[model samples]
Target: MLHVTTYYDTLKVTRDAPAIVIQAACRALMQLNHPDNFEGREYEAVKIAEDLREAFDVLIDPNTRAQYDNWLAKQMEQSN
Candidate 1:
């Protein structure tokens, strides 16, 4: 089976990770993938940064995070 990456994976956090940790991980990853830092690969860096930002937005909100968790749980169960 192919491995799929989720929002938590994007942020490098666990299922129950705290918002602070999520924020920090997103910040750290964004820093590494920042367009200015990648120069010639700015487009690729921006794409990655955008994904990271989307993950951060979803994971940082309690309501959306809860919805996402439910969805993730279902996905895992089905995968097994």
Candidate 2:
């Protein structure tokens, strides 16, 4: 299986980071990678922004976030 980092990694936040912090990180990343903010790199920027949005969505949902956390723990345990 391909190893993928957790949503927290995608947002560059700690696993225990609060929702407000995660929201701030998401907003900041979106602004930085917004398609309009890039000139010739609009396509790449848009893709990154989309990924950040997806990560934000998962992390913002309590149930999904908990599930993701559990999965991440298992992955880490297996890796070790």
lDDT of 1 by residue, 12-38 (tens): 899989999999999999888888898
For candidate 1, the clash count comes to 0
Worst window of 10 by summed lDDT in candidate 1? 1-10
Question: Per-residue lDDT tens digits of candidate 2, residues 1-80?
Answer: 66776788889999898899999999998887887888888889978987898999999888999998898889888987
Alpha-carbon TM-score of each model against the true structure: 0.91, 0.87
The lDDT values for all models are: 0.91, 0.89
Q: Which structure among the candidates has the greatest lDDT? A: 1
Candidate 2 — which residues are off by over 4 angstroms? 1-4
Question: How far is 30's C-alpha from truth in model 2 (Å)?
Answer: 0.5
- Give stretches of model 1 more than 4 Å off: none
